[model samples]
Target: MTTTPSLSRTDWTLILSLALLTFVLGTSEFVIVGILPDIADGLSISIATAGTLVSAFAITFAIGTPLTMSFTSHLPKRKLMLTLTAAFIVFNLFSSLAPTYGILLVLRMMTAVVTGVLISLAMLVASESVPTGKRGIAVSFIFGGFTMANVFGVPLGTFIGQRTGWETTFLLTTTLGVIAFFAVYRVVPSQLTSVKTSIADQLRLLTNPRILIAFFIPAFGFGATYVVYTYLVPILKGVLGVPVAWISPILFAYGFISIFSNMAAGKIASHNPIGRLRFVFLIQALVLAALYVTTSNVTLGLINIALMSFMAILLTTSTQIYLIDLAEKFNPDAKGLASSLMPVASNVGIGMGSALGGLVYANAPVMTLALVAGAVALVTALLTAVSHQLDQR
Candidate 1:
């Protein structure tokens, strides 16, 4: 028999603080999309060149996460979290002050490296802070912070960037980072021990087929969404005929719906991780297919976008929980590396999707992105089914 640990108020406070930390980092990462045009105009670069900032961040994050985690594996969780938070704040501040696009790009890469490690560490903290049974909920709460970033942070940052400048968005992120740093300092318990594992042990987990497959589940799953999502503004404005002014609000609505979807995912994931992922991925694939069909009409297009956003994030918590659980069961000594790989795989998916979207945008109509992404989502569902069967066996 298994028992769920009871969480106290202090645990909830710590969880909320970690969530806020993710919200701050997520907003800094994602706000670039909303302000891409401003960044291009401000730096006298083409929008396409400015867009590389996004890719730079994602690529760096993908490469940097495990590397950073390996180096910091010996440090206490709270101390490492605080250190990363400080680095994040300082780098984002430098980003806002970057005079040239080149300098800004470098600063963003620095921030991404730290942010990736920070998020991975945050997950470890959250999972350790909660009862074993509630790990899913804690992970979801942290991810919910990112959802909140999309909901309030990105739109508001977009509005501010449009009016003042894109640099202002970075400055704002820095401020939020400061607040998050203090919150973590005050609330998060400092006695949490680190997961100590040698480099060889960590590397050995990579050789495991199950870990490798589990890592790619998110890579393809997120790739499916980001392929269309990278060009969502153009899709809404040029293809769907939505006015420029309404794009933010539409995104705001999409983000708003995502919050509930994220919470619902948390609940469903706790009960049935594999089944929940299958359902979410299947719905995501179908919705992307519907998005391809609906792009010609504004109402249907908006509805499909909302549905896609809703279903897209449903896999996040489950993915985190499943991977971590897998790590604990199969690769206990290297659970840190396993946890870190979740975000790394996610960024890989983001990078792939964005790169593919760019290719489609150059050669084909934007609506075609949906078809390609939908196919990817279907592949993700199949992978989930295979993973489920393997677990059952």
Candidate 2:
């Protein structure tokens, strides 16, 4: 019989530190959505142009993560995380000081590359530190930091940005990064490491058809949400007729609900990842579709927004577990690559969804984001079914 690893105070501290780092990183990534209008005005750019910052960050993160993980696979986890955190701090500070829209865009892409690496590595660290039975909880704890960012960080950042300026929001992220750097440096053990694999092996694992399909599931599922989320501020202001002051509160509620959803997904995912994902995708698709009908009423629109937020991230932990397990099954040596790809797939979805949302916003009524997103969620559900069948076989 297997025994659970006995964790000491240090282990718990390490886990919590990683979670805190993710909170900081997630806030850096997501806070921009709340302050995009401010960014546009500050830089004298169109809101559409400002929206490209999201796409730029997502695309860079998607492309950079696997490559970075492959190259750094042999490095000591503690050193690698510290280096990434240091870079994150420097770049976020620069982002706050960016003099032009173009400069800010470039800075965001650089920050995103580091953000991607940090998230994947944190998961790897958590999984390695904990017993198999507790890995799901560990992952959930890390993700809890992310959900908390949405719950408290994003809304608070938005409020600060609205009052003081968007630069202040980035500065706050920089402060958080500084805290993360210290926590990681002090708490994360330097000896933590993963199985080393050759570049060729990592590349081969990434090319597997099953793994590729798994990757695309998140791309579409998350893309479905980003379709509407990229323009959430505008939607609240225009469609729901919500006052600017009320937007942050509503987002806070949406984000708070997401925390519970994320935790629940983590717990359920360990038991039946494919089944949980299938159910989540179906509900998400339905919620998004309901948005088309409900968004005209302020109360209903807020409720729909909350529902969508709750449903949108339910697959995250499951997808992460599924990809890691699949990679280990196919090539244990390439597990790092597999683990790294989860966020890559997610960012790809974000980029696609946000870019598509931009197009829809330009050409159609803003409410149409829900329809487009709903269709994409349906596609995600189909992908989940296919993945489950493949797993069963």
Candidate 3:
């Protein structure tokens, strides 16, 4: 595709609106982690049980998203987006009022059912609304919202939860969702058409070897980061000898760096995505490996981690564009399902990597987890190379 000079104002509006919606969605999904203890205390549940909200949301998001998206593929694009956004707000509203831990857990899971689909819809809308060359930037900005949530929304929500109450965190999310809904409605075209397809049509995407391999790219790429990220606090405190007082600032800085990483991913996806992804993962693998040596020194450890954070989402935008582009080639009608794959694969990677990391952490030195994650990142590079080769054939 020929490169466009710049996105038009209208395109920017639509994309930004979608980004705002994703920021809200991202905040809702992740803010629970910071307030897990508060939630446990509020509901008289163990902290371990409160932690299940995070895992449950991720599992449901991975399993439920494609099914929900596939079944709703025929709906008008704008309506589907609005409906999902409204549903998200309603779920969060209820979540804010749940009287019991079980009720809150169920609401969080229900919220997950719509969360991934809404994010996928945002990416789909952004990609289709822009020129081909600019689609990458559009999608990246949509993903950028999540990073922004990490940078701004999650931290702010955490503060609110701590100072006020945990329930207030969901209420904050609901307020943001309401704003996002209006932004989406005002900017998104009401007549946006969708490619009509049956559930079988969407499921048939799994039969394509190219796509099957493509799905694993995000899984491995993201898994590489999550393995270590899942235990980041412990690594910082135990391995790097970082004091408790500095942890928040360090995490805030990490999230701040991730926003730039998200922007870099846009440019990578703008052309030759698979080829670029091959090297992105390779560099990421090298960075993760470096963490083994760096963890022994506080300054080096922080810098290496910042570098790792920069590499974290480098694959996300490109992988997303890759999946949607492949679907367009082999099965145009299944593009909605394709849109859902990046998030689904990402959650799968996170779950798998965290589980693997937990096992390793229990049995080996914490620094060893970085080497294991690096190996997974190398696998991501290998998969990308294979994907690029398949493209040639």
Candidate 2 Cα outliers beyond 4 Å, as residue runs: 1-10, 34-52, 99-103, 159-167, 233-245, 296-298, 359-368
**Candidate 1's residue-wise lDDT over 1-393, tens digit each?**
977777779889988998999999999999998899999998999999998998899889988888778767888887888888999899988988889999999999999999999888888888877887787888888999999998888888888989999889988999999999999899878787676778887778888889888888999998999999989998998999998889867877878998988888778777879866887788889999888789888988988898888887788888887887888888887777777888888888988888888998899977899999999999999999889889989
How many residue pairs clash (N, CA or C atoms closer than 3 angstroms) in each of the candidate models, in the order given? Answer: 0, 0, 0
The global C-alpha lDDT for each of the candidates, from Candidate 1 onward, is 0.87, 0.87, 0.92
TM-score (C-alpha) between model 2 and the true structure: 0.88
Write down the lDDT that model 1 would get: 0.87
lDDT of 2 by residue, 198-281 (tens): 888787897898998899988898899999998999999998899999986787677788888888877777687887788788
Q: Model 3, which residues run further than 4 Å from truth? A: 1-5
Best by lDDT: 3
How many collisions between residues are there in candidate 2? Answer: 0
Pairs of residues clashing in candidate 2: none
Rank order (by TM-score, best first):
3, 1, 2
lDDT of 1 at 282: 86
Per-residue accuracy of model 3 over 1-393 as CA lDDT, tens digit each = 754768999999998989999999999999999899999999999999999999999999999998988999889888888888899899999999999988998999999989989988888888887888898899989999999998899989999999999999999999999999999889998766676767898999979998989999999988999889999999999888899999989999999999999999999998898998898999999999899999888999999999999999999899998999999999998998999999999999999999989999999988899999999999989999999998988
Error of 1 at 109 (Å): 1.2
Q: How far is 358's C-alpha from truth in model 3 (Å)? A: 0.6
Worst 10 residues of 2 by lDDT: 2-11
